[model samples]
Target chain A: MAELIFTEDPEDPRLDDFRDLSTADRRPDRPGGRGLVIAEGTVVVERMLASRYPVRALLGVERRVRDLDLSGVDAPAYVTSAETMASVVGFHLNRGVLAVADRPAPPVVSEIIAGAQVLAVLEGVGDHENLGSIFRNASALGVDGVLLGPGCSDPLYRRSVRVSMGHVLRVPFAPLDGWPEGLNLLRESGFTVAALTPRPGSVPLRGLREKVGERVALMLGAEGPGLTAEAITAADLAVRIEMVAGVDSLNVATAAAVAFHEVAATR
Target chain B: MAELIFTEDPEDPRLDDFRDLSTADRRPDRPGGRGLVIAEGTVVVERMLASRYPVRALLGVERRVRDLDLSGVDAPAYVTSAETMASVVGFHLNRGVLAVADRPAPPVVSEIIAGAQVLAVLEGVGDHENLGSIFRNASALGVDGVLLGPGCSDPLYRRSVRVSMGHVLRVPFAPLDGWPEGLNLLRESGFTVAALTPRPGSVPLRGLREKVGERVALMLGAEGPGLTAEAITAADLAVRIEMVAGVDSLNVATAAAVAFHEVAATR
Candidate 1:
């Protein structure tokens, strides 16, 4: 079980990990200059406890901490007044609870591809909210894992964690280095890479399930400039959600959800 | 063509309609204490110029105003520097354009329903962003119109206009008065009112496409507390998106997109 510590001072040294979260995504001391994994609200905090990321500590109101089932947790959980937490964090957090976690060693791409029936490979999904939404869709639709290509934001970022409803922790993700070249690995693993684009030449999304039912590594890009030319070339086939003419393309996350449902439904 | 009149003063009374947008949604002068239809960004501004809403005025940078194909537009198109625009609106205008339009008389609920093939009926979707996204999805998926049930936010609000990518201007919408009682009017119009719920007893969404073709009206509620008991009971059928176990429901707009795609596919 976790140990509960009470603190009143906002400047307490032990609370440094939970400080100034608005700019927490950039950490000078960290290897990649990225912040520690942060889980907010009770639901996300519960997910963090179940994830592989090592929990560093927790800070929350008394009621929130008492609500958590702390068995097997070895970290110190701090109980602080809401005002003190707001003072320490530099913002008023209404989530009432938060958990700070250390980043774990990333899973191997091969491991994710090996066990997956359906996978979502994202490229240029730089927006944290979009990346988070994709992970949420990927989790709910039974996409086995996610392969993050270049230009993708950190799924463990606090905003991403919150937007994803903490599913980023529950879903296994591994970075796929080397841009389009890394996509070759999935093809070799008996996976058919289906690149999602609204291009005229691409097959409709509904038809994709019939074309590649064995295994699919569904690729998606950011909303505006969709899958890069080279990325499209890497995929086995290009698929698009057939949409009305003249209307703006669907939001990247919403489009991914629609496509994910189509692919997952038949599988 | 739009005549661009340059303005240097931030306190110009002519720009009051575009001032302090954060609080502009509530207007004491307008009916129901709601603000005039406001559009932000060049795309949405152009859409407003083409909509039925009477253009009141426009505030934008020179480049943004020049980009709009404003032929036949009679509104005062004020050209201002970004700094002046920021001072007037209480924030930096990243998109560098704004347009205010008088709210047009909404179509009658029966009129909106009479000519519609596929329609979205929303209840308790009070979030401006979600409301806008639904409009965007409905337009792209070829839904003929939208019926605002109880507790829906105004789609003409600025945030909704921006989030909808201006599609709210093109698609028609009207309020469905008298709660679930008005739902009977939909059945009278030869419509299959399908309520979207995650309830265990609800039929899967895919099956509903085959069951109700051509004239289907999909009803959706807000994210957490889904369709109310009264609303679900009013529908012809309750349909559900088959999500993986243990995961909470998708965002309201996202679930709407999935339902939209299903209906579109059938059409």
Candidate 2:
């Protein structure tokens, strides 16, 4: 069971990890940045406990702390009054519970490509919410893993974790070392890397499964100004979600979900 | 041409529709509700100008006002400095432009159903962003119209309009009356009312296109606690997006996009 430590002091040093969360948990790679993975609310907290990330600590109200099934949770869980907790954290958090975990080593890119039947390759997906939604979609739709290309935000950022419903922790993701050339790794591994672009000469999203085999590394870019020209050229082929004339392109995350469904669905 | 009357004062009664927009555009039916349809940013403003809603006035910086193709716009375009715009809006309106339009009489639900080939019937999807995203997806994926069932937020809400990239202005939506009984109107209109749920015995969404004909009314509920049991029971058949075990359900908007694409795809 996780150790339950009750604290009333707002200035307690032990509660430092949960402090000033709004901006503090933003850039995990920056200086003075505590690179801890933070999970908020009970649903996400439970998912954190179940993830591969090592649990560091937990802070929550008495009821919330007690409500969690903390069996084998080695870390300390601090139970505090909401007011004291708010004073420590710099703002009121209505989620009632929070958990912080140390990020595990990133999975190897080659390994993700090796084991994946269907993979989502993302480039320029810097928006935390969009990145998180992609992870959630990847998880639910049976995408084996995600390969993070350049300009992708850190998936372990607190907001991304929350927005992903903690699926960011569950989905295996690794940064692809090279740029457009890095896409060759999937091709070499018997994966058909198809870039999702709206450019002319690209194939429509439908009937893509008929063209490609079982292994697919589906590449997606940010919402506006989709995949760079070089990235599109590097992929095996370009695919697009056909839409009506004059409508704005789908949001990147929603587009990812639609494409992921098409890739995962049994036709 | 839109009359670009420059204003220095923030207290101009002409800007009332644009004031305190964070709360003003909410609950258009409530007491003290101005009930004006508001669109933020230049893209949505242009969409509003081309929509059925009557453009009442515009509040924007000079560059943004000049950038719009305002030919034939009968409404007054109030040009103002950023400082004055911020003061009048009760916040820093970063989008550089804002347009408010008087909502025309809502299209009849039967009329939307009659003209529709594919429609989305939303129940308990009260989140403004999600509702807007659904509209955007519906427009792009060729879902002809939207039927707002119980617990749905107003698609004309300012946040929905902005999130929808002004597509809400383009796609027709109408309120579905009489709860579950209202669903019969769709069935009578030759729309196969398919309730999207995760319940057992539900047909998977993968091959849904093979079964359903041209017209489909895809019903979706909010994120958690999906469609009410009564709503599911009332539909012609239940459909589910198959997922990996133990994963959370897809976001309401994301799921709608997946389903819409399936319905719209040329197989």
Docking class of 2: medium
DockQ of each: 0.65, 0.75
Instruction: Give lDDT for model 2.
Output: 0.89
Q: What is the interface RMSD of each candidate, in Å?
A: 1.9, 1.4
DockQ computed for model 1 against the true two-chain complex using alpha carbons? 0.65
Task: Encode model 1's per-residue lDDT on A132-230: one tens digit a residue.
Answer: 999899888778899998889999888999999999999899999888989889888888999999887988886567788578899999989989999
Off by more than 4 A, model 1: none
By summed lDDT, which 10 consecutive residues of candidate 2 chain B come out lowest?
Answer: B26-35
Fnat for the candidates in order: 0.64, 0.82
RMSD of each: 1.4, 2.0
Candidate 2, B-chain TM: 0.96
Tell me the number of clashing residue pairs for each predicted model: 0, 0
